[model samples]
Target: MEEALPIRKIIHVDMDAFYASVEQLDNPELRGKAIAVGGSSKRGVVAAASYEARKFGVRSAMSSVLAKKMCPHLIFVKSNFDRYRELSQRIRNIFFEYTDLVEPLSLDEAYLDVTENKKGNPSATLIAQEIRQKIKEKTSLNASAGISTNKFIAKVASDINKPNGQKTVPPEAVLGFLENLEIKKFYGVGKVTKEKMYRHGIFTGKDLKAKPLEYLQEHFGKSGSYYYHVVRGIHNSAVKPTRTRKSLAAERTFSENISSEVYMLERLETIAEEVERRLTKNNVAGKTITLKIKYSDFTLQTRSKTLPFYISSKSLMLDAVKDLLFQEKMKNSVRLLGISLSNLNNEKKEQQPEPEESIDVQLKFDF
Candidate 1:
């Protein structure tokens, strides 16, 4: 038999509690303090909570009222999407410098394929270290990175050490790691799934892997095949880049609702800057600009402009954004403001050229 194929190296990079951490980093007073990003009212949910607040049992998706009850001195601030997006762009630029095969899970997380990287480095562990260092140096932020032979293992490795941590799962160690891992800790195995697994005495990765394929299929349905492969440390997913812009948007909701158009414009300026950076990064022009407004009561409205020609420059894009903003009729005082650009060009071919296709005739067999 022929030799087996070499393993592909993958890395998963995730920022630590991105929004809350950024807020704490910007305002030194908030450091080591319990802080949550959301409303203090009954209707609000916690978008993010600082590490300090987490110590009080506060978490994302929990009610702000409950969070406040847990930590009486909790600081509640509204979401600042503009600032978050700006920081996310800077992080993306850093990822591009290392390898272009980056698949962004969201603004705060991404998977990078570095089997044949530009750094000429043989160790994936070193690449993870370098990327983490660059993110901290450039953004003053902490990121957790996981390096492994594939996405499944790589993603799990990243979370092993969080908050400015990096870890690697070498191919030789994968079996031992998987065998000892708690079943509940496996990706996609949520509380409900874990409960069912517990009822069936499947408490570890080894337990799941030892089960008959048919038994797993009978219980977990189609995902049984997926679990089987993952437990065996075999994943086939490739790092795909299919980011097409159906729309580009920048939005911000304030801590306190205000009716002042002057204050709204100031906020809009920051939002416009973020949109410009994204447009420039994609090298695409937009023909339509939309302005979104959310009133104090949470009612929303929008005014849009479809330009004669596509434009992406900072000044031109901001002008269209301003025009859209000015055209909207104010009702009950705006609490949130946003700007978006759409109708982008998808034909830019400056980055990579088309590869020639070939058809081979011979298939050699060693019998």
Candidate 2:
């Protein structure tokens, strides 16, 4: 007889409108009001939107101008990242109380593996509820969660209920849950992939499962395999406690397009300084420096150079950026400028993988 595979319990916790919620939490008057956390200037983008603002079609990454137009009464508040980070740390501390196997996706969201946890809890559903409640008690913020056997399903389930609620896809329900899920709601399917899936008559998990692996690979390339297994509830990704930072960058979008090389260099100097400060804070340096340019027509161009040694100083970074800047003439007036550093000295070395355990067991557990 074959040994039964261990069914790990995973939970994905996502704070509700984190940045905007922080703004609202700090200012009682801002509560229950439509607000956006970002500049309301012409070039400003919405960093986050309150649930009230979301009802008006204001969303993060939307232009502030459009956000205001969408909700004329929308109030714009400047972002307070320091406060956000402090509260995020508080929330993360709560997760550590239950399990050290926590993987933070961002300041507002994380994946927690609690199959065998400090609390000795076997019910991931109850664990998720406790975490959410503790986050509220500690930070006065609302959080939603998804509980499931894998990270992908847990992540998708987390969004089923918004603003302080959770959903658990138990082992027995995983297949049916995924089959009925909208193709767009699959964790990895973005607008482009959704359209491609639509073109291929893949409208939902069931539709995707209907195609053979070879057919999927022929059309979707490497990702076809990913779609194939995830829909069948075969995702086995572990919840890693620590994730390495791949790159560091800083950028600014101008209020007006500037074509002069001197002006561009002036802006690049400031951007490089910001990047250097971030690198110093992270205590890492990089060999590759890239200069990103966005033209008035919204076209982007990037130039990079790699050095023999890692350098994090603004002076060194600016020197490389200047070469890349002058290497090519301005295709058009520039609207945005950015500096990024890759090939960092702190990159993690690859480790050999262990074979994955099967997820083929019938899960009768409760969330």
Report the number of the highest-TM-score candidate: 2
Model 1 gets an lDDT of: 0.81
Model 1 lDDT per residue over 182-262, tens place: 998888888888999998889999999899878988999977767877787767677766655667788887778877777
lDDT of 2 by residue, 1-367 (tens): 9777677899999999999999999999999999999999988899999999999999999989899999999999999989999999999999999999999999999999999999887789999999998989989999999999989999999999987999999888888999999999999999889999999998989999899989998999978778878888888778989888878999999989999999999999999989999999999999999989989887779999999999999999988998999897888999999999999988876542222433446566555
Best candidate, lDDT: 2
Model 2 residue 97 CA deviation (Å) reads 1.6
For all predictions, the C-alpha RMSD in Å is: 10.4, 3.1
List lDDT for all candidates, in order.
Answer: 0.81, 0.90
Per-model TM values vs. the true structure: 0.67, 0.86
Candidate 1 Cα misplacement greater than 4 A, ranges: 1-3, 243-367
Residue 329 CA displacement from its true place in model 2, Å: 5.5
lDDT of 2: 0.90
